[model samples]
Every structure is written in structure tokens, then in C-alpha cells.
Target: MSIPVITLGAVASAFVPGLEQLRGPVTVVRRCEELAELVAACQTGLARAAIIAPGAADLTASLVDRLRFTGVVIIALRDHPPGAADPVVDGIDYVEASVEPAVLAAAVSRAVGRFEAESARPRDSHAYADPLGLPDVMVPQPPDATEEPGTGRIVAVWGPSGAPGRTTVALNMAAELAAAGSSVLLVDADTYGASVGASLGLLDESAGLAQACRIADQGRFDGAALGRIAVSVAVKGGRLRVLTGITRPDGWPELRPAALGKVLEAGRSLAEVTVIDRGFCLEADEELSFDTLAPRRNGAALRCLEAADTVLAIGAADTIGVPRLVKALAELDDAVPTATPRVVFNKVRAAAVGRAPETQLREAWERFGPSVRISAFLPMDHAAADRALLAGTALLETAPASPLRLAIAALADVPAAGDTRRRRPGQRPRNVKFPGIPARLPR
Candidate 1:
């Protein structure tokens, strides 16, 4: 039986005549003039493979992912070698447009064979496998046979909405770790409001994290590639490797969970501690409304939490902030039951609670919050925070003796057990019970 194929665009049309002439291995089932028609044809199960031109309308990474999800192989015909001007799409096989019909047929057959093999294999529940079945072409191997790969600790800084000092905590913690001679990679994964670049005085508009995700989605992510994309910022104690977040909110689709997960994996091999500043929302409502394969806006934050060795759940100290944090903690427990986040209350002050604030806050937490323990309380220091913000640096750099800085530095001492218990790629995190909270909180 001949394998059915669809062709799109003028370049793809030129090959149809030759492909039909040699009809033993494959057959041209349809010739689509536009991307929409090609997508429709593929969705109807009319073809197993699509030969698309590079200039196909609305041929984005998301579209490519959707097409691949339908069990269709995409062969993108490239007019020339990929460069900065014309980058390669993530989940497509690029073949030289001038290749002969025989070569194209063989390529399609090989791709199909590999796809079938991958589909038959049992997939890991925690991570998504490359849709294209591409090998890890650029993964760095350890030099000595006896030496193990670097298993850096992943610390994710998360919080509820209303500016609860997530970025402030993440930046200082990473700086302190770096100051203590540990290599650190600070990633700004906040899709909604990405200000890590501007916060640290990095004026460059390049979306480092997005670029890394694209490289990761292509199965070519490595420590070297990460280094190339990330910018180095020198701090008081040491320098930090920073991966800035997306410049625009619409770029959330670029930070797919699967790709971001791979980037975190590579980050472990690159640094001693990887600090990620995550977004506020954890809701996966998109999953309920859209297909299982749709791009999730909050998937990036959830994925970071899942991969994190330690989760620093930050919240403000005010009346509104405390309740928000408590509610968010319950949601966090439901989202990733295995995650035991270290609760941190930022901007803590006597005014927020009564005099003797720590004692009052503790009593309230025990009554209203889940059974999780409070990790640290960062006192509100507006002057110090302002200085750091104005200087575009961490508190350690601006005011080392500030009370808030001291509090944030102490958080660095928390052990990262993930270094020792490195979960295998795509392996689900083992279920570890939270001390007091039940597996599922009352909704």
C-alpha cells in the first residue's frame, strides 16, 4: 500500500508531479494552496505526511505542534541553510528543497518509521517526548566516565497576584547563592509581567528564555546553547547567568511546558543552583476549554513548580496578602501534591499585624492556613528596596546590611534535596506528604 502525502505552497506543488511519477512508495493525496486548507486536509485524516513550503501562511511553532499532534509528519522544504534571518521551526523536519523525489520519499519513510516507533514506546508521564522523535543532538556528556553530570538544585519563586515580592525574593536568593561561590542561573519565567531584565538593568530586548525554549523544543538544547542565549550580570558577591522572560504577554505560547521542562533539565547541568521567578497564576482552565494539545498560558509556571527542588511561596504581610497566600497554598497543594513549598511572608511589619507581628502572624497561620510551616519573614524595608530597584541590582549589592537582605540571604541555606535525588528525565516526582495538610484540601 502506498503511503498517502499532502503537498502545500508553490514549492511543494513543483515536487508533486515528480513525486506522483514514482508512485510505488508514496502517493500525492492532495495539493493545498493555503495553510488552512492543508490543516483541514490533515485533520480529516486525508494524509499521513505533509510537504510544506517554508513560506506557508501562519506556519508558526504552535501550528506545527498541532499538526504533529494529529500523527502527521511535517517535512518543511527549506530554500537555503538556516541562519539568524531565517530560523528553523521547532517540530518540523527540514529538507533541502532541491532534493530529488527518491531522496524525499526515503526521508518521509524514515520519519514515519521513527514516529511509529516513538508512538509504540511507553511515554513518561512527567515530561513530553519530542514530537519529531529527534535525538538529543547537542546534549553535553560528562568528560570522565566516573564523573556524574551536574545535578543543580532548582528553586522556584512563586506567589499569588498583587505583587507579593516574588521577583525580589528570587533575585536576592540567587545573588546570595552566587556570592557563596555557587554557580547560579536565574530565569525570569513570568509570562504576564516580565520585568527581570529591566529590574537588573539589562536593557537588551532579546527574549532569552523564549529563544532557549525554541532551541529546547527542537531537541538541540545544551549548556553551551544556554550560555549563548543567557546574559551575565555581575553582582556584589558574584555573577549570575540570567535568562530574561518574554517581552510581550502574547509570547506565552512560546514557553510551552515540554520545552520549558527540557530547559530546566539543561539548566541543572549548567549551574549549581537554578532560581526561577515564576508567574502568579496556577489555573489550568485552558485545559478544560481547549483540546489537550492546546497551548496553556499557565503551563509554564506549573511546569516550573513540578521540576523545582524547592518552592519558595512568597506573600505580602497585609490583611489581603495573608488570605491570598493561604488560598494560593491550597491551590498549590492541589496542583502539585508532591510539592512542599516553603512559605515566606514578605513586607512583614508591625503595622500589618498588631505589635509583636511574628507571634500574631503565626497564630493566624495555624488557624487559617494549611499545615505547612512558615520558612522566613522578610521585613518591609522600603528604602533598601528602592535603592536596589534604582541601582538595578539585588539587595546584597545595594544594601548588604539591610534587614531584608539578611532575611533573604538566610533562605539560601535551605537544603536542596533535589541535588541528591535527581529525578530521571520525564520521571514523575515521587509523592511526599505535606506535614499537616491532607492530600486534597476542601474546595
Candidate 2:
């Protein structure tokens, strides 16, 4: 039987003669000039298998998602071999770009058989969102009482581009959750500015996140492996396991697609609460025709939100920050509707929004997002925050009874339905190094 195919590359037209040599009626009938045209062909069900080159237009996760929805298998032609060191993302199969015509045909034939088998079976719930079926990092609360216990909670602490104390909240949240006798893993996932280590006084320059991502890229990231990368920090009642972000600014590419999620999945087995301090950018810039699995700084943050059981969408109290937060809320809803966010206002003061700041901020946010109520407003605590940062420790340790610590502790008290007793602080499951790092935080 014949198979339908679409070709997209600079020398795409030259491949027609080669495709015609297939023993079966293999048709390279459609040649897409632009990404839009290729997408259109896939939408109309004209393209079955796309033979795409390394740099064929802007191939984004969103586009790959679209193709997967319409039952299109992506056959990527790269200069490298398919193995542990390959730079390919999920949702696409890779073959050597310089392969002979006959070898290419074999790949296409396999793609057809794989597609037919997959299409015939019941559709996967995550087929369109994450077609590659990379490990489902999400540990959703068990629907019934019979569901698994001790599944950790993922709380993504995110906010707008302008500084709104996301790291502070994340650290405080981890501390509070730890104080409640839950093991915590605080991850610095803010690709734009990774300050969790510095805030906690850790100066080891280990680039823990980059190393974990490297291991994941090699497809050897499991729970045992995850334990090796984490640095232990004693909080209060329980310990805080930290996964430091990239060592440098341009190191975002180190965190490839599905890598961070694999780390999160691994962390769940060790911790009771996972606090991911995410970057400000939630935008999915999949419009670039690069590889569908291209390295994106914001992609890590997006995945954190996707896998989170609770999303703390925070923002600054005043003028510019409030407006950005409002716009961000709408974008968040459009992007990850599965994540039900709890809105928070950081650095709230009467001077920022005048008397009755909460009421005014609520009134302003109600226009754009009527259903999203301002759940909590963190008060301005300069002295306590400064002391914690300068001391290279958590606010709870510096000022245990401070208002800031109390506020975060209140948030930690939010009921978790399917939780079991967790380990205490300073309990090292994997003993690699000593406890704690001397942090340097930015004001």
C-alpha cells in the first residue's frame, strides 16, 4: 500500500525524484513553502508524515501539538545520530540527514505503521498537549480515597515581569510547609533571574539545574538520579531540598523540554511539598520554525504551571505591576486552563494603592478577571526580609514570629486532601554533601 508524505526544506523540490523510487506508491505530493502552508496542509488532512529538515521554518511546540492532533508523525532529519547525545525534543523521530533514499523510505514506512497502530488505539488524554508521552510529571490528587497517598504537592510561585517578590514568597512557602512537618524541595526555575541559591546564601556554583538537565537529556533521569543533584538545607520542622538553576544567564538552553518535569516527578518521591519559583514569562514562543523541541527559557516555567496542583499567581501592589498582573492573568488562563491560580499581591502597602489598597486592587482586577479574587496580600516587610537575605537563611529562621513568616505559614495551612506524614528536617535520604549553602540575595 502507498503512504502519503509532505516535504519541507530548502532542497525539498529536489527530493521528489528520490521519493518516486520507492517500491510502494510513496507520494511526496505536497511541498510546503512556509510554516503556515505546512500547517494548513496538516489541518486539511493532506499531510501524513512530514519529512522536515533541521531548520525547516518555525517549528514550534504549538505547531507540533497541532500536527499531532491531526495524526501527523514528524520525521526529523538532523546532522547527528539518534542517541543519548541527540538534541531532539519529543513528538518527533530523528534520522540522519545524510541517509540514502532507501533508508529514508524505511523510516517513512515505520512511521506509517506506528501511526496506524497509535491511531487505531484509544486516544491518549495528553496526546495533543504532550504527544510524545514523556513521563506525566503531574501527580493529580487521587479522585477517590483509594488513590495513592504521599503524592507531593507542586506549588508554582509566579508573577509578572516586574519584581514582585516571587523568590521571597517561594522561600517563605517552603519554610512554612517544612515547619508543618512536610519535606520540601524548593526549585529556582526563574530562567530570567535565578536567585534562590543566592537568597539562601548558597555560593557553590555547582549549577545543579544544568547538571540535572544534562542527565535528563541523556534519558537517565530517575528518582535515584534526582537525589544526587539536590542540595539539602535545614528549614524548621523539616528540611528543604534545593535544585539550583543555571549557573549563567545564557544557560536556559540547558533545561530542555521535559527535562525539568522529569526532575519534578523525581522530587515528588522525596518531598511532601515542591515549591517551584518560576520565571515571569509564560509566553509559548513556538512561532519560530526551529525544532519542535527547541530549548526555551519560558518552557520550563510553563511546565511547572502545567504540573502544579496549586498555582500562586502573584504580582506587585502598585500601578505598573497591577496592570501587568491583570494582563498576565488572562494570558495564564488562555495558556494553562488546567491550573487554577490563586491571585496574590506582594509588597502591599497603603502608599502603593492608597487607603484600602486591597479593595482598590480587587476593583481593578475584577474588570479583567471577575472570578479571580485576590486571595492573599503579603505585607511589606523590609526589615525581616533584609535580615533573612543578609543572614543567608529563610525568614522563618531569622524572624520566626514576624508577620511575613506568619503570612506564609497561613498559606501553608491550606488543606491538602491526599497527604501522608512526611520526614523531618535534616533527614538526608541521599548523603552526598553537607547541609546548607551561604546565599547572597539581591535587594
Candidate 3:
């Protein structure tokens, strides 16, 4: 039996791509506003399916919810998706140019065949819904209940190999921003190992990334749920919302690229400044053949980098560290072709490198021709950092006078309290400022 044909009511120019893959009868309609006309057309009883672009201006939660008429299967087309390009929605089948048209035709044929499958096997709701008996399908509500351009600053702190203190810098940077009275969210996207919880002295027994993936999987992550999962740590006068990493490496696969991207996107929506704690850019070997226990997709961190407005690359100040930083710069160049990372030299205590660590890094990076700007230089102060970690406190609270803390503070002070400035293309950055060292930022 031939699969009944569907008419496509797409926002202008969007229907061409799917037509290549969809062999069924396709009627290219105009804008989202014409959905009503399309529905009226369906009343003629010729079309059994509708191909609608979710990006269409007329498409809305209300609109989709109303599309429950019998014998009509509504398929929403999105150009790109939550992770990769597999566009099959929970209820709708996706037809695209790349895949065999037969695959989609078969899917639609299955739906038509299954009109009686629900009644034939009348399973309880529990069979379809999750174990908790919640609704099986929970599509994400648009942020603010309306679609608008996002407004937030996301600074991703990434470094090269050899533990160049990416976490430390991220922690203090978030703290300093919060101290200056900016609402900040610190995300631990380090899929290899997440130390943000430990670094901040947070017990964080609750699900962080794992739960986030679950929520995102349902596509129902909202602003309120985002707040509930974020572990709060006291910064200067403000608070730091920390999203810790996955507890075990085995769960890494669950952190799908799209889900992680959604979490970050949602986080940015709620924060004045979002600081990300990323894993080593050089360590892509999260995938180990022998270790089924540890599947290193590294998807979470990479997604963060790709979505980042600014990336802060950390490098150790020592000879070995400098060379590694040089190479790490190369890797980031390839991995994130779209992003321009701000390079910072951490633990620059040795006078042997030069009096000015920033100048040295600038010189080295310039030779590579990537044009990296040295943003900040944090001196090495192991004693203070160790003491803070042991006490489960931040260096700002544990050792206010430490040179390392001061450097981080100075670097962090560049952005004004609640500055909300969007980064422009090809903008040059200057040193971050600190009015003066205080007893501490108000808690």
C-alpha cells in the first residue's frame, strides 16, 4: 500500500531542503501565519500529513498543541538540532535529503499502521511514561515564554595539557565577578573529571550533569529547574551558581552534545556572567577501548567551547608548560574554528621566565601567527591554594593577601559589576581592574 501523501506548509524557502528527501506529495506553503490556511486545506481531506518548520514565525506551543486532528501527522522540521542532525521528534517523523526517503516513508507508514496498536495492546500509562509516572513527553518551554535574542556573557576557561589550573582560575573568576555584584554561574564541563564540587567544598550529592541530561532529554528544562539544580556557593557580595560535572565517567555518554548545549544556553539566559570550568583541551582521549567504565565523549566540554562567546585558555608558566600551551593553542584553533580564545598564563612565579609573564606569552603566541591576546597572569601560590582547598573554601576567603588571589581578582575586575556587554567581533581586550584589595567581597 502506498503511504498517503503530506502537504508541507513551511516558512518561506525552508521547504526546498526536505523536498529532496520527501517523495510524498509536498505542497510548499509560505509563512508560519498560513498555518490556518493549511489546516483549512487539510479539511479537503486530500493530505494526511503536514511538514511544518518549527522555525516558522506562526509556529508556537499553542499552535502545535492544537494540531491534534485525527488522520493528520504533523512533522516539524529543524535545520540543526539539540545535538546532531537526527530530526525525528518524539511524536513526529523527520524527512530530510540525506537519509533514504524510504526510511521516512516507512516511519510514516508505521504511524498509519499503528492507529490500532494503542488499542490492540492497551498498555498502562506507566509503560510509556518514566518510572516516576511523569508525562513521557515534556518539550522545553521557550525561555521567558517568548523567543528573543539571548543576553548574557559566557566566558569559557580552557587550558592546555598538564593541569594548568583551569579550575582554579574559573573558580576565582566567578567569585570575583560575583564579588563585584554580578550574578554568576560556574559550570564544570570537564567530562574527564569534575573537581568544581571538591574545589568549592560542596557535597553536591544531587544529580548535576546526569540530571541535567535527563531534564534536557525530556526537552522541558526551564529557568526555575535550572536554579534548583545549580549548587550555590557564597561569592563576595553575590552568589555563584555552580553546575558540577558528572559524578562518574561511565555516565559521560548520557551527557549528549545537544543536552549539554541546552543547559549552557539556559544557564546563560539566567546569569549576568557565566564562567565555565572546562577540561584540558589537549586531553581528547576520554574514549578508552579497554575501559568500558570510562567513555570519554568529551562532548560536554566541546559543546561549551563551540557555544562560548569568549574562551580563556590557561597555560602553566614553566618551560614545559609554555611549550604545551603553545601546542594547546594549536588544538583549540582546529577544534573551535569559530571561537577566539583569550590566553592567560597561570602560576607565573618564576623570575626565570621573565618579570612579565604576559609579555612572554604574547611574544610566544605571536610567533605562531594565531594572534592570541594575553588577558591575565596569576602567580603561583600553592600554600594559599592548598590551605583553601583543605578547608573547602575559596582562596578569596582563606588567604585574602595571597598574590595569586590578588592576580585573579585584578583579572576578574575588568568587567564592571553587572556589565552585560555583548562581545563584538575583533575587539581588543585590556587588563581587568580591581579598585583595591578589600577584606573580601561582601558575602
Q: Give per-model TM-scores.
A: 0.69, 0.60, 0.58
lDDT of 3 by residue, 1-443 (tens): 34444444443234445644664534333333465566655434445555665554354444433332223556555455345654344456544523444454555566645632331221121111122233321121222311333466788889876899999988888887777787788888887778887776665544466566545543556545565566566543566777777668465665666767887777766676778888884445454443322443665667888888878888898778877877878888887788787677787764647766656655766775356766667777889888777756566666766667767776675433322334476342233222322222211
The number of the candidate with the highest TM-score is 1
Global Cα lDDT for candidate 2: 0.69
Ten-residue stretch with the least lDDT total in model 1: 432-441
Which stretches of candidate 2 lie above 4 Å from their native place?
A: 1-150, 287-293, 367-369, 414-443
Q: Candidate 1, after superposition: displacement of residue 427 in Å?
A: 43
Q: Is candidate 1 or 3 superior in lDDT?
A: 1
Better of 2 and 3 by lDDT: 2
RMSD of 1: 12.0
Q: Which tens-of-lDDT digit does each residue in 1-443 have in candidate 2? A: 67788888755545668878765646886987776677667655676788887788555676665576455778777766667875556667777877877788788889867865653332122111112233321211211111233367788899888889999999888876766677777888888899988887665466677666655643455555555566666654556777877758767866755778887876676576788999889888563553433457878878889988878888898898888888888889888888788877878778988897767777778875548767777777888888888866777777765656555555555222222225366432221111111111100
Residue 194 Cα positional deviation in candidate 3, in Å, after optimal superposition: 0.5
| RMSD of candidates 1 onward, in order | 12.0, 13.4, 15.6
Clashing pairs in 1: none
Candidates 2 and 3 compared: the better one by TM-score is 2
